[model samples]
Target: MSGHSLENLASFVRDLDSACSALMIEGKNLFAGSHEGVLRCWDSATGDLRWSVEVAGPISGFAVDNNRVYTTASDSLHAIDMSSGELLWSRELEGGSDYVKASNGFVWATSSVYELEVADFIEATIWRFNENGDELERWIITERPWYFDLHKDGGALLGLGRPRCGYLKIQPGEKPSHHQLQTESPVTSGCRSSEDCFLLGHADGTISSIGSDILSDSDSNSLVTDIASLDLELISGHDDGSIRMNGTQHQILGSIDSVTLLDKDGWASSWNGSDTQITILGDTTNTISHNARIRQMHSSDERLVIGDELGRLFFLEAEIVKRRRSEIGELDDDENKNSEIRARLRMLRNR
Candidate 1:
């Protein structure tokens, strides 16, 4: 490549009409979904739009496994056949979100709900489903969901709630278990830490980690505890660039735009739109910033892809900088444009 210049840029797909939100890479296909109800899969090697499908409503959060794509909209969840672009199944569930994951032979989703039609406080529920689109179970907990993900073994799920940080562990065919952590603030988002524990972003622009042992009760369904459990401790947190506001502010900053775990090693990444900062979760001291406001962060293999509010697509080689980032722990504040730091990154455009 030309030293991270525009020459090595892969390819790009952009639309002035659709606001892109999610990105994924499956095999040689790079996929993106937008608010315009369009979902397209592009060939990673060629940057060609291999296939695209448009549905009735905007696509929020969705996952593709084998030949099926599971998606969630504002009021429903759907299972679609990727090959034919045909709707396989759809369910009417309120509070649909763009946050969905497929693991442990199941598709999982989260949504907010109220006890009554017009209640004030919000409570959220997490649902699990089999690949065939059958709803297995739902776990309703104390607060609105701020974060959710499956454990490493896929045997269990973790959810962190907000207003009051209510944490719960949900396993198939068992009562959801709850755990207490030191964080008592509103949780904005979370992901698995480098150590397999969990990272939770606070409204105050801080990030913290919870030990894996706290999730020990994850698989209560098993007569004997699952071997996936590991003894760990709470990794302290630091200011990850969240700016504190007074009683009144736009309230957009400090919230999580997207989260992805680095594949090569122990690095976990999340984008905070509030201050336009990308934190290497466990190593919160150093962060990255994009020229524009970032709306999503995703990865497949060694490439890290980003989508922004301007309907632009970008791509970077994550593994190239992984070794250097880990060794330095925290990069110097003025190193972003440093020639040595820009070597392995490239952007992809979607026109």
Candidate 2:
């Protein structure tokens, strides 16, 4: 650990994987689905290869639930068992499935909108499926949904696109309700921070929070620093750990080019332009540099994992940066309490 600590914990480079494509971090297991059509899982504890499997090429999306890993490549959706890495099911979708989400007993997929050759127009399809592999409903969206996140409290799903953005609320045994949000410049990325509040990244280098209140000046601003100057959303990372966006556990903001998540120590790196600098959300002075521009970024509790087009994966771990937060002090999430529980679970995995 570095002696010069920010807030409480010093952020340091933990490890690097020279070979990487699409990456996901679930608990202590880090999953990488490469453009080479290969998927790998590593034991984050020892940085050991837990299991590796070869799959079809150019994976566009990767996700995980309690039991399995869901992936999309080409127009196909594949589910692999979390423990054994065995293929449980695979299905093909119309057009090409560009994004996917699995949560609250349902799996969702969306296809790219623009024509394959020309980015001239937008037309896309969204598909929903149940655990038994039965197709529930498919809807068409005028603006493509490039990314999605499950509402933390459940009963709803969040979707993002350039021209439009919205959330679909699903009630038990009832039709889902969808609502559209207004945005100037394209809404490149979005994620639900809490039940009442969500954050969105816009193409003009801006991130905004949309909650029950529609007219709060504090809701929108150019907080992305260098990224704001270069309206790009290159890669995205999901909040699957203890890090809080903007110091609150529920607030998460994202752009299309780079994955942006906030925390007490600042933020995990996401990109807006060709630059390779990772900005700490509020602390613009502190940044970790990379040789290549970041194409994808993901996170665990303490680890920020990023992949570049150069086929390399870089990782940074902030020593629980939340420990140093002044006003908030420490993270109030269950991570501290769950550490004892996960320690016990780790023992089982070793066997």
Candidate 3:
């Protein structure tokens, strides 16, 4: 159990075909879907197959809660039991679905394809469901709304359009309202506000914070990719192969947080797009981490599990470190090692 080593937990059925589109984990097992139309479940810690099912389309999105595993294909959605892999309920949707988040007793999602094909019309929708697979409500807004934030408070939904453009707020039954907080550049990628505020990364390397009032303009051109807010600081992963800590109180850099590089097995080189996922613990200023390439990830207060594209999973115990020196000179013996770590981090962020 080295600090940075990945362990092979399990592999999916062969029909999954060496390409994992999305992955999810339940209590003690791992579930994955491939570019092919196979959904396979394996022991979370041992990589042993529990069950496999062939669906109508490629696996697009997945979520797990207790004994029930939920997923979305091109034209359909499914809920299956974890133990026996029995199909419990199946529903249908219009197009392809991309991401799904299960929390606060709901499954929230966005579309895999939101590009406009019709002359002047494109539809991106969010569907809500109950535990028993009943469709609760749905909303259609914008031409292509991808990433979303379903706030813990009620049913508040936050949607992002193409970058440099602004974002929207979707209340239960009200018309979607725009924030109009124009960006310095097109926002290439973004994540939900792990805290009360939100983070957006622009195409030109600008990272900004949006508060509740929607008029606050606090941003920096730091070339950041993914971010997580913790305590009173923002932990950001950058395209420059570095992770920095910025002060939320006065809006400035606190220090050059932690630096990490790609591992030896080409895990960092495999990242394809701006889809890396980062989550931070709200209580600690140093516990920020992420995973790329659609692997399963989970974080509690004490531990984290990162599953990779190669079907290897890494379990890490949390470590909180402080800035031991001033940020001024060239690499020392220890800083030289840290530089390599930062290089790997940048490659992941840029990809």
- TM-score versus the correct structure, for each prediction: 0.64, 0.67, 0.59
Give lDDT tens digits, candidate 1, residues 224-305.
1001111222222123322211111111224334444444222222235444544443333345554456656666566666
Question: Could you tell me which 10 consecutive residues in candidate 1 have the lowest summed lDDT?
Answer: 218-227
lDDT: worst 10-residue window of model 2: 226-235
Q: What lDDT, from 0 to 1, does candidate 2 have?
A: 0.55
lDDT per model, in order?
0.54, 0.55, 0.50
The prediction achieving the highest lDDT against the true structure is 2
lDDT ranking, high to low: 2, 1, 3
Give the distance in Å from residue 69's predicted Cα in candidate 1 to where it truly belongs: 1.8
lDDT for residue 269 in candidate 2, whole number 0-100: 46
Q: How many steric overlaps does candidate 2 have?
A: 8
lDDT of 1 at 40: 72
- Rank the models by TM-score, top first: 2, 1, 3
Candidate 2's residue-wise lDDT over 1-351, tens digit each?
Answer: 222222123231222223355777788777776676777777665556677666666777787876788888776888888888888888888776677778856887777655758664377766778855688877766666533656655544544454555545554355657666554545556555555565665544345555655321222243222111111122122322112333233223332235444333344444345545444545433454545656666665656666766554444565445343332334345645554464455455434
| lDDT (10s digit) by residue, model 3, range 38-123 | 78776655545688887876677777666677788766778888789999887776567655656645665655344466543256
lDDT, model 2, position 183: 48
CA lDDT of 206 in candidate 2? 45
- When 1 and 3 are scored with lDDT, the better candidate is 1
Model 1 spans with C-alpha error above 4 angstroms:
1-11, 14-16, 114-121, 152-156, 194-196, 204-206, 212-292, 318-351
